[model samples]
Target: MVDGAIAGAVGSAALNVVSYLDVAVRARPTSSTPEETVGRLAGLAHVDLGPEDRAANRRSGLGAVLGYAVGIGAGAVLGALAGTRRMPLAVGTALLGGATMATTDASLAVLRISDPRTWRRSDWMADLVPHLAYGMAAAATLNRLRPPSARCG
Candidate 1:
């Protein structure tokens, strides 16, 4: 149970680190204008937007991190309670984390705050890597707590 809790915490930490990396990458200058950079990042992350949206994406990204913290907390509690049934906890937590990000990004878009339309492939590529890394870490960490009966080995 202790191990499961630790693993869950580690998984959440991994997600946080990856998210931070994504932010750092986006902070770097690209061909994108300042106004477009935020919106472009939101688009790359699959968040929809409109002219009336005024939410600050960078701040929302911070909120995404907070949401990840909640997901991790939930996962750790579930993992500890479920013991050998960690796989579901892990998968659920991972999905929750993703959903949190999508929600946060979308909310910001609703307020009209976004990146420039000229977001480059390189910028998006940099962002993609961190998200993938975070997902992998989350999966691996949660796998440790999965029951033998789970589909995963």
Candidate 2:
């Protein structure tokens, strides 16, 4: 569990780095989906976030934190699933990336945060690339931390 959490943290950092790099290269404004998602969830939950200024700030922080939670939780699940089994890197990456992407996209769709159906190619690219980076990093890290006793040989 600990190993998986660490791996997930590493992957989350990788995802952020790739995302920021994209932002730098494209000169596009950062996506507000995270904040919006938080807002929507809060509303549905009947949780008040305080004044508008403070709420916005809280939303931003919560948005980023929620991302990390998802990444870490996903990693832990992957770790549990791969216990004592040596999954190939390509397969592991695909599984991890697909899982994370599906999780985020599904939540957004359910919450009406963003519709994938209307997203352009560029938007999809933006989402895909960072997630791939995340998968690659998390999968590699998890494998690196695998217990020797668990190796398939």
* Overall lDDT per candidate, in order of appearance: 0.52, 0.89
TM-score each candidate: 0.44, 0.95
lDDT, candidate 1, 8-54, per-residue tens? 46656775576566667668532223235445556779876544444
- Residue 115 in model 2: shift from native, Å? 0.5
44-93: candidate 2 lDDT, tens digit per residue: 99999999999999999999999999999988888887775566778778
Q: Which candidate number would show the highest lDDT if scored against the true structure?
A: 2
Give per-candidate clash totals: 14, 0
Residue 96 lDDT, candidate 2, scale 0-100: 82
